[model samples]
Target: MHIAEITAVMKLPSNVRYEYFIKKVTDFEEVWGLFSDAWATSKDEDGNLFIPFFPKKEFAEISAEKEWALYKARSISLDDFIEKWLAGMKKDGIIPSIFPLGNDMAAVSIDVLLKDLEMELENY
Candidate 1:
């Protein structure tokens, strides 16, 4: 039931831009978790610190349909929330590599590599 490789990153071809690699991870919670974890230095109104990143429990609370649209609105600047997360992933060295002609291939492969992919958080 476990795939250790889900957490493992592999090498992509050399032609794709790393930035767009960040742009394709539009699955809502995936983008939210990655970004929330990476830039979690924000504070709440009362000055108590609040991290946007979801815990496993919180993630489990999301429904696949709504989370995507909601998170997309919150996270994505151009294409989708996943793409934005891909940018964050690249910043954190989470993505392996990319190629020009193999852009679609690279994204698909990356998704395979991160096989723990779930849409649970997409419920919003």
Candidate 2:
């Protein structure tokens, strides 16, 4: 199975950093599909989709409040948002690559965020 780790960092209003990590066994296409659906379903008569301010399970790990807000407030198309988001992730080296061929056993340290954000994978 292919595993990807998603880390999101947000600077709250009080300067208290909020960081969350999500790890899942999914690929880029699946991730894209979720966002596409969200955009399509949320589109208004003006063709603008207002994305939620915070990360949700549907959207992949995303950072930067300004960029996200700008996209939503400006009514950027879903295509544009997807391209920009993917490009940014690639530029930052956060885009997960395809799983290695023939790798049956792989392990990754993932933060289990159910109860506490700081919880480690080993403990779970």
Candidate 3:
């Protein structure tokens, strides 16, 4: 995907983008994230840290600018994301920011994401 396509996806409504994230990740069996020395993260007004993920590498690539300049897009297999990452993130109280577009994102809990992904996969 290119920047133009990404821009269109970004313009999509929050719930639509969230659905797109889940579908794309499950369809590809992978999720994209920006990483350098650590995973790329953002904070809410309350100062809670959340790691952002993308359903497409292009999304991650476009986000890897400014403060995230040193970060590179990396792919995480869905299985690892589910069986390992999610549980660890849940224990650590880290929110998963799905398909963020600027200041907007679907910042959901690990359990919520897991349940949604499971439901989506059930249709397959």
Candidate 4:
């Protein structure tokens, strides 16, 4: 499947916010590569670097479940995205860990825009 946009907003324990974007990824592997590259290049406000988790089909599926319309309408919360959608993905082994970035009190928000790639991808 193809995705036009995926946005991940991470609110770290230190109250620092990090936003990651994935655009026009054609498959799960591409998503993994892009996420890895972004994490490798990312630095905190203090210039501390952190590693990123490898993207899996489960991660893509979690992204897919996000309703862009609802998010745009401001009807979703970062806590809901983590407690509901991401928690489900974790059960399915899509996410390696709930707190991959090591933020004890982190919250994640995801927004996804799906592309019609004629692959019968699932959307939630």
lDDT of each: 0.31, 0.26, 0.91, 0.28
Candidate 2, 1-124: lDDT as tens digits:
1123222222222112212222221111122212321331122346533222222332322321332332321133333434564455445433221111111111121221222222322343
Per-residue CA lDDT of candidate 1, range 1-124, in tens?
Answer: 1234212222333323233234334332333332322332233345533223221222212311232323311233323333555456545544332211212223233364333233332332
Taking every candidate in turn, the Cα RMSD to the unseen true structure, in Å, is 15.0, 16.2, 1.3, 15.3
lDDT of 4 by residue, 1-124 (tens): 2343223333333223211222122232133311311222233466543323223333333422222112111122333433563455445433222223333322232222112211213321
- Please give the lDDT score at residue 85 for candidate 4: 38
TM per candidate comes to 0.21, 0.18, 0.94, 0.20
lDDT of 1: 0.31
Displacement of the residue 71 alpha carbon in candidate 3, Å: 0.6
The predicted structure with the larger lDDT, 3 or 4, is 3
User: Where is model 1 poorest over a 10-residue stretch in terms of lDDT?
Assistant: 55-64
Stretches of candidate 1 off by over 4 Å are 1-31, 34-38, 41-78, 95-124
Q: List the residue pairs that clash in candidate 4.
A: none
Worst 10 residues of 2 by lDDT: 98-107
lDDT of 3: 0.91
